[model samples]
Target: MACNGSYTVVIVPLQNSLYSSDALRFFHWLKKLRALEREKDSLWIGLQVLERTRFWYQHQLDQISQRNARVGTRELDEEEESWSCALRSSMQRVNGSLGSLLNNAYVCSAAPDEMDASDWCLRWTNAVLTQEVSQKNDRISILEFEKEILLQQRDGIHYF
Candidate 1:
């Protein structure tokens, strides 16, 4: 009997699962916000880049979801594995470039339901675009900052 014979071992860390969930939530929220941003009353639409962006972001969301499903279910095909690995790497790389506060590990002070994590994630995304980050560099906080900017901007510009 060769001791080297492989034994099946499945290990799924809670953190990895949470991270994937966060990624999905973030992407989903981003999709909706992009839609809202294209209503001729939002910034991206005001810039006239919403159509191209909606297409681009839709593609990204699909890609990320597919990859996450494969990885989460351990059904990753060669192509899916490649894509999943690439997306994870890209996320990690982009994540590293961002302030740590913007990483996916942030915890909300209240329950996840108390505040919409999806919306929160969008805020960090906007902050990252603005090249700003919270003191701790948490991604959620970064998004919060972005949300603040948008609110202020909206309030300043909106006649109501």
Candidate 2:
């Protein structure tokens, strides 16, 4: 669902399957992956990359502006130097995390294209977008797993 949400805006099969029990397990897997992503985020590594990019680019622009030499130059004329720099540097910072974001580019900007990652993100996002999606799956799984027991009680029959 995560990748589906990010990659396919028009709706896809993966998006529809997020309601299944197996898909829910995939959702749980995604939760673990997101937890790790949160831990890394807590380290401020992402922030550092952003700040590094922002600070450096502005510094470069400032130097250029003060020199009166960068005037009218393509690099100088463009605004949001920090943004451009941030995008590039953030990609570099999360170089190894490509799989985490599913390499969707639209989801987390840091995810890779690995199968596990794509699976996790889709499941994670599915869980996030709708609680009922998960609750329904959970209810179904419990019923399925305990179907025989439930049937015995309801039918007043004893097991061999």
Candidate 3:
């Protein structure tokens, strides 16, 4: 499976049963896909707006910084320079994280063309449940290991 821009593409071998059993059901599925596409486009537009706003705010900040630099003493200028460097670095990190989060938020499971909605849903649900159970088991194991270590420490202290 390959994915880009909030959509999943499933590549499967051609099969005899590739056609949908119910035309109306397929129509509804197509409608839902269109709705999702519109939502995705809206989200992209909102992100672009936010980017423009951020740029405008940064431009204003640069003007203020320049004004301060012109009036401030040498010592204050040095301090301000360092502070601005730190602030810019932090801002870049935050912006990078936000971009990553936004990109990742759109990813979702999608069914293959050959699979019906019900089968795809069931498969997805099972996969999620299996992952959850595995994680829970790992947590339980860690707790048990910690408990054993604590008990051993207590025994050693009593003997001492």
Candidate 4:
């Protein structure tokens, strides 16, 4: 007899056609194998999520760096310098946290039997994604405010 879900069972002839204790043990082992296969699949999925998140963070960092380079070296006012410092610090923290998450995912994938580790990976990924979304919303809001200010200025100039 063969079982599905990545398990194969072989039954050898034992006298006439009759059930045996050995067959029961094989069935139990097959069930256990299937459970392990499911766990392995979950672990694989967590690893893939971590890899994608890492790639996205890296790409964002690259974009920020390029933008900064284009801005060139101009003397920043105190307020601008403070804002720049805060943004740099935030980016560093994000990068460090992402690295830690990737490391945890790698370790968890190595030991798929650790259900707790897999759960932690899922939670961490969710938190990181939420934070990224919030940051993007803030950037969009800031851009919109700037656009409104520019439009108001144009209107005032045309009215003069």
Model 4: worst 10 consecutive residues (lDDT sum): 1-10
Every candidate's CA RMSD = 25.4, 27.0, 15.1, 8.4
Ranking the candidates on TM-score from highest down gives 4, 3, 2, 1
Number of the top lDDT candidate:
4
Which stretches in model 3 have alpha-carbon errors above 4 Å?
A: 1-110
Runs with alpha carbons beyond 4 Å of true place in candidate 2: 1-43, 69-103, 107-160
Scored against the true structure, residue 103 in model 2 reaches a CA lDDT of 61
Across residues 38-154, which tens digit of lDDT does each residue of candidate 4 receive? 556655666786799789779868976876886767644554555556567766876797788778865554433343546655765797699789789768866775676679779
Between prediction 2 and prediction 4, the one with superior TM-score is 4
Candidate 3, position 151, lDDT: 90
Q: lDDT by residue for model 1 over 72-107, one digit each (tens)?
A: 667655544544554566457554754454454365
How would you encode candidate 3's per-residue C-alpha lDDT over 95-121 as one tens digit per residue?
786789578765844323434555655
TM-scores of the candidates are: 0.22, 0.26, 0.36, 0.40
- Models sorted by lDDT, best on top: 4, 3, 2, 1
CA lDDT, every prediction? 0.53, 0.55, 0.63, 0.65
Task: Report how far off residue 157 is in candidate 4 (Å).
Answer: 15
Task: For model 2, name the residue pairs that clash.
Answer: 1-122, 2-122, 98-111, 98-112, 99-112, 101-111, 103-111, 103-112
